[model samples]
Target: MQFVILCKDKPDGLDLRMATRQVHLDYLKDVGGANLLGAGPFLDDQDRPTGSMLIVEFPSEAEARSFAQNDPYAKAGLFVDVEIRRWRWGVKPPAA
Candidate 1:
């Protein structure tokens, strides 16, 4: 199933996020792999990242939760909140 991993950064987490960015990218590339459908950050009014959203596929919600928990950004305590939900691609689905 596909899941959406939504995360809100801590109020002062930009430095931490920037510091861990490359490792976070590596983790996503290494672990998420083909299961990663789409991912990016949520921008604030100043065009700075305030949170993240990732759409990923996994066998179960439990597995998806585990993946979210293991993200480098998560491990680094960059996020103040995280939410995981089953998702449906209702429009403009990716080409096969």
Candidate 2:
């Protein structure tokens, strides 16, 4: 099953986010990386990253929680809030 991880950064956390970005990317490149489908940061009104979202496949919610808990950003306490939910793939749109 696919899981969606939504995370909101702590206030004044941009520096931490920038510093830990590569480490987070590296985490996704390591073990349990295969489940990774896609990930991106959420932008604020000023176009600054304020949060992040990652979609990954996992056999259970336990695994999904582990993935989120182990992320570099999470380890560094960059997120103020994190939500994990099972995601169902929707019908794809036809080509234009």
User: Model 2: which ten-residue window has the lowest total lDDT?
Assistant: 87-96
Kindly give the stretch of ten consecutive residues in candidate 1 with the minimal lDDT sum. Answer: 27-36
Per-residue lDDT of model 2, residues 1-96, tens digit only: 989999999999999999999989889889556788888999999999999998888999999999999999999999999999999768672232
Clashing pairs in 1: none
For model 2, the superposed segments whose C-alpha errors exceed 4 Å read: 93-96
lDDT, candidates in the order shown: 0.95, 0.91
Model 1 alpha-carbon drift over 4 Å, by segment: none
lDDT of 1 by residue, 1-96 (tens): 999999999998999999999999999999999999989999999989999999999999999999999999999999999999999999999997
Error of 2 at 10 (Å): 0.4
The C-alpha TM-scores of every prediction are 0.98, 0.91
- What lDDT does candidate 1 reach at residue 43? 96
Residue 48 CA displacement from its true place in model 1, Å? 0.8
> Scored by Cα lDDT, where does model 2 land?
0.91
Question: With candidate 2 superimposed using the best TM-score fit, by how many Å does residue 41's alpha carbon deviate from the native?
Answer: 0.3
